[model samples]
Structures are given as structure tokens and as C-alpha cells.
Target: MPCQSSEELNVLVKEAREFTKDGKVADYIPALGRANPHDLSIAIQYPDGQCISAGDIERKMSLQSISKVISLALVLMDRGPSYVFDRVGMEPTGDPFNSIAKLETSSPAKPLNPMINAGALVVTHMIKGNSIDERFQRLLSFIRELGNDATIQYSEEVAKSEFNTAYLNRSLSYFLKQHHIIQEDVEELIDLYTRQCAIEMNCLELARIGLIFAMDGVDPDSGKQIIPVHIARICKTFMVTCGMYNASGEFAIKIGIPAKSGVSGGIMGAVPGKFGIGIFGPALDEKGNSIAGIKLLELLSKNYQLSMF
Candidate 1:
């Protein structure tokens, strides 16, 4: 496949930036509300190591729910798929990211999948460590290893803010406890989950991590296996089925790639050995996906033939 020239990518970035005008920054999280709605950036890394980026590709942002994929992968690696699956199901719920309706009605009360807030909280509890700091450090290490960036760290402001306002997540954690789903203390697990979501990185760093998924859990540039092949497959499957909150199906139809979006207006997309795309636009649509980021991915997928489907 021919690589896109920097000039061509720049033009596409400019076109995608227009979408931010139609969307608004996520205001529910006060920390996230401070982002510039018009901020948009993109970075693409090819299997052979070619890199192209446009706009504010270096601007840092919180990982938000995007960290769920990594947390799921880490838990699967530490405790096999059977153990992880026993705690969280793989089915997608067509509801919002934090919906608890299913928990009240679903027979087993397990979370539908790890992409949603409830499911991610369960996965975070499953992470192996003695203390919250230890678990968070382990998670940060895994992300840095996959991204080949050693500077990734948790944003204190984001973590503290989320910790203070995570009422829905707290309710979900307690509900999971009532059902014997969560094995850890509810407060501890919620803190762990919130900290994971607060991990920060830019599009370039995120693109590197996405490339590992594109290469089936192996770091393409270094040929190091960071995540197991089976776990990688499972993660990609969930990304396709439930990564975009309730809009996962629509994103699959339009973008046709395994991807995940964060409330902080970041997206990580894997194209299975072809390319990895990272996009950021703080403004989001009703479903909590970055509007401009989604547009950029759709255009890039069509133009580059990067869809996994």
C-alpha cells in the first residue's frame, strides 16, 4: 500500500477540523470541559514505520475510557481469559456507557462488556496488585511498553476531579459487589478505575499503542509481543462491538475499523498490520464520541483502504 504524503494528510486534517464546529466539548466532566472544542489532530503510523501527522498532534489529553482496552488486556494477561470472562461478559449493550439498567435486570448482573464504565470498573478490580498505586504503576508500565513512550503519567487534576464526581460509577461498583461480581473493596476499585482513565498521552503516543493492536499485539517497529494474540483478538472484537458507547455499530458501518473513543475527545484505531490512526477533537456528538475525530477516521479509512472488514 502506498503511504499518504504529508501534504495530502494535511488537507484531510483541515477538512476534518470543520466537524468540531458542529459538536460541543464534553461538559459533564468539569476537567474535560476546559478543552478547546476546535482542537483537532491526527497521527498515522504505517506498519513499515512511515509516520504522518497534522494539527496539534503533540497536545496531551486524558485517556478516559480508551484505557479500558489496555486494562482489559492487562487483566487477561495476568489471569487468563476464562477468569476475566467469568467476571465480565463479552456482549455489547446498546445503552449508554454508564447505563445500570442491565445490571438490575440481567440475570447474572455481570457487565455486558469491558468498554463501558461499569465493565471497565470490573476489569480494573481484576488487575493484579497489592495497592492502588502498585496497580496503577503496573498499568502505566504496560501502556508505556506498548506505546514505547516512557513519559506517560496520570493527570492528577483529571483523576481527582473524576474521583470527586464519580457518583454513577460508585453506584455501579456497589451494585457489582451486591451481586458478588467485584472481588475488591468498592472504593478501592473505583479509585483504580478513575486513575486508569486519567492516564495522559498525545496522538503520536496513542498511535504507537494502536499499532501494537494493528500488528496483533506485537510492537511492529520492535517486533516485541506486548499482549497475547488471543487477548488482542478479544480486545479488537470488543472495540468493534462496543468501543464507542452506544454508537459502536454506527462507527463500524462508517469507519470499518477496530477502534475506541474516549470522553476526552481521543480515538485509537487499529487497521490490522496496515496502519494505526490516532485522532483528537474535544467536541463530541450526543453519543460521547468525538465528532471531528470520527469524521477524520472515516475519511482516512476510505481513502487508505485501512478497514479490517
Candidate 2:
């Protein structure tokens, strides 16, 4: 009842789950390597309070890059678009999410897009808080507010694991410090960024948060605007261009919807006026996206005609 067909979703999930064998789980960060490759789930929420879902809905996964969109929305709410955009450009990079090659070539060293690690670092730095804890708590609260779910919390094990292996991210932040894009201690900001990426949520919660952005920052359950309409538009635009890392163009063309994906094999999608979708499949393809997740979405988009274009 969440959308128009829960029965159909049950069938689709079964077919999509079959594709999980084609991809591999993300294992660079040791903790992430522990996830079961066979697990897959999808959650869909509509503005009218309907919930449709299938698969392993109880599975827990980190936000990964999908947190970038949340951080961007929070920064925009606190500092507005001009201030946030001034630090990060609206452009997309064809490079990998953590690549620093663009920084060296670009004179100002502004991150190519907010969805990348470099730009997400800048956006996290702009979060309004005096201390690292305050800033992280602010972000956590904002995420919970969106989904109306206060139980959501960061996976400290995952965050610390990310911290232990964040050599490239550390280097990226140092470069930002060098360019003066970030003024705070480099370690503190990277910690915040990693923690944001480590926040854990299930498919149901992911769908709720996606629903918020899908509704232009308004939570229909609460009948309140948690984020401004214009800022949501900005975030959604970035999601389309850079949410899938270098595979964004293909995803936009094939899926034709605004979506953000995380390395945990999670993708948060907004179908404009229709519905919000959250999918999880631990297996990833070469581009760091859930191979099974993308396959499921393609089927769903075709069935529901969910393409925004």
C-alpha cells in the first residue's frame, strides 16, 4: 500500500535478489568486508503514508557516499546555497570518488562536486558547530529528523574502521587545508566526514529520508518543511550528476531518476511526485554501485515508469 502495489514488489524483489550473485561486496574497509554478499532488500515510501517493501529489510548498512547528500542538505540549511556552493562547485567529476587529480589541476582546489569526498569534507566543515561532537550530533539529528526515526545511530565500529584505513581521505583533507578551503584541524574534519558516512540505517529508514527530499524537504508525516525547497532542488541536482560517482551519467540515462548510492550497496532514490525508494544489495560492480540494486531499479523504473525525464 505504500505505493500502488506491494504484491508486485514482492515478486520483483525475488527476481532482483537472484542477481546478487553477479557482484561482490565492498571490502576495502575491513568492516564492510564482513557483510553477506547474498543479502538484498528494498523499501518504498510514498507521501501519503504508504509503505511497500521486500527482501531483507532488517539488514543494516552504512550510509557511505549517500551521507554526502544529507550533509549537503544540512550545510545548505545552516549556511544557504551561496555559502555552501562557494566552497564546492556544481560540476561533476568523471574520476573516482576519492581522486585528488582534479584538485591538483584545478587552480582553486575546489572539489568538483559535493558528492565526492573532497567536496563532502568541505560541506561537513561548514556544519554549524563549535566542536566535532557537536557537528556530528547536529548531522545525526538532522538525519533522524528527516526520517522521523530517532533510533538511527552511527556504526562506531564502522566509523573507527574507516578512520583506521582513511589514508586517501586524510590526504584529501590535507590538500583542502593547503588550499585554505578548510581552516579547522584536518583530522577533526575527516573524523566528522567518516562518521557521517558510517551512520547505519535499514531500507525502511532510508526510504523515509529519501521521501523527505522527494517532497522538497517536507515530511508529509509531520506536515513540516525540514529543508527549504530550493536547497532540496540543489541536492537532487547533485544526486543526479554525481551520486553514483563516475557512473552517474549512465545511471541518469538508464534510470532517469534522482538517486544517491553508497558503497554499502545502498541506493536512495527520489521519484519526484511519486515515491522514494531505498535499495540494498551488498554486491558491487566495478563502479562501486550495487549491481543487483541497479538491476532491480531498472525493472522498477520500467514497471512504474518512474523516470523523471
Candidate 3:
């Protein structure tokens, strides 16, 4: 019932687009820096195959951290909750997404949750495969199926850029390696992880993926359960707790949706049992979330009473 038409959604997008000025594109990844800070787009997907969109919904962007949630779900299906949670904690962190401070201080030394970079690395490590390419291909296949798009692929430019500049990620991997949380070569893991983060798609495809999560992992078209109910619940729980990096708590208070954000200025939100939302606003706030994207979500949530809480 929310945003029943593109015209209604366009008005919201115009209003939220103003916040784009207050943000800046993420330059840390180098390739992600090329995005237009003023660009804003949104797509909403319903279980009944209805979709409403605004802005350039077809524009492709790297998954960035939003890939973390998908990867987490894949690994959970791969290794099961017992094995995965044994290596990663279930709690959220208050530090920056890429911060290494918590790893040193935490008693067990595992990343607090799968949403942060450290935990994401651990989850990526758990992906079942005999080789890097095999693992990455499997993960990609899973993602493709989730979005119902075979054309989904990674941006080599972004992948290479993140792989080269991921010095801090290397540190986290080495630390986890030392603790025996992961036994693979750090470089190899980084290669696969970077590719995982670099997976790219348009906002419409992104919304379809969110729609799967919103529907408890069932593909409405095929009626196939892509992700188990319990696993989907766990992934959604993390999205609520840590999806927006350190700003997750505030995002919850304001937007109140199960959402994940990426530094590429992408947000994937699942409004339980209703619809899925995908947003692209490359301008990022201090916490590395899309500024206009969050504003738009806030507007939609308020207007439609979409908050789960």
C-alpha cells in the first residue's frame, strides 16, 4: 500500500534529494569516489510483483558493505548457525564499521557481529569452497538467485581498488588468522572478499533482493525458499542492529526498518511482510551511509507506517 505509484514516490525523492548536498562521495575506495554525489535513486518491490521507483533506478552501483548481509546469509546456509556463530559474535559494535580497536579489546577477539568489516571477513572466510574462484563463484551464484538476475556481476575497478587499499582489512584478517578464527591465506581471503563487496546491480535488482528477505527468504515468483526462515530472521536481525555501521542505533530510532547500507551509498531495506526498498545516493554521511537515502527511508517509513517496531 505504500508508494502506490512512481508519481507519489517521485515527490518523496525530490524532497529527500536535498540532503545529498550535506554528504560527500566515499573516496576511501578510490573507485567508489567516481560516483556522482548528487545522484539519488530508489526502487520498491512488493511480494506481488508490483514495483514503484523514482530517479535513475537502472543505474548500477557496487554492493559495498550491503553485500555483507547477503554474504552472511550465504555463509549461514553453508556452515549453519552453530559453526558460523562460533567464529563470529552475535552482538553489535559501537565503533566504526572498519575499526580494529574492538578486536584487540574483546576477550575472545572475534569481531562483534557480521555487519562490521572484521566480522564480515570472518563470514567470507566461512564460505564453502575448495578455491578462491570456486568460493567467489558460489557466492555470486547465490546472490544472482536472490535477485533473480543472472546478469549481476562485480565491478572489477571497485574490487581492485578496494583490494589494493584494504590495508586495515588485511590487519583484521591477520589478527583473526593469529587467533585461529580463519586458516586461509589472508591475501586470498581479501581477494574473494573484495570481489564480494564489489558485486554490482541497479536499484531495481537490489530491491528484489530485499523483497526476498522481507518475505522470509521466499521467492514470490517461484515460491521457493531461497533462504531458510531462521537464517533469514538472523540476517534481518543483524541488519536492524548493525546495518548502518555506528549510526545503526540512530537509524533504528528514526527509520526503524531492517536495512543494510554500503559505502557505495546503497541501502537495501526490507519492510517485513510488506515490501523491499533499494536506494542509491552516493553522498555519504560521517558514518558512511547514504544521506539522502536515509532521509528518503525516513520519509517513506513515516508516511506509510512501515516501521516494524
Query: How many residue pairs clash in all the candidates, one count each?
Result: 0, 2, 0
- For model 2, the local distance difference test gives 0.89
Which has the higher TM-score value, candidate number 1 or candidate number 3? Answer: 3
Candidate 1 per-residue C-alpha lDDT over 1-309 given as tens digits, one digit per residue, 9 for 90 to 100: 323447877888789889889899978888999999999888888778888888878899999999999999999999999998888989998999999999998889999899988899989998888899999999999998987788888899898899889999999999999999987887888788888999999988888888888788988877788888989999999999999899998888888899999999999998876777788899999999999899988888799776766
Q: Model 2, poorest ten-residue lDDT window?
A: 1-10
Provide the TM-score for each candidate, comma-separated: 0.97, 0.97, 0.98
Compare the candidates by TM-score and give the number of the best one: 3
Which residues of candidate 2, in runs, are more than 4 Å off?
A: 1-5
**Who wins the lDDT comparison?**
3
Error of 2 at 131 (Å): 0.5
Evaluate model 3: give its TM-score.
Answer: 0.98
lDDT of 3: 0.93
Q: Root-mean-square deviation of each candidate, in angstroms? A: 2.1, 1.6, 1.8
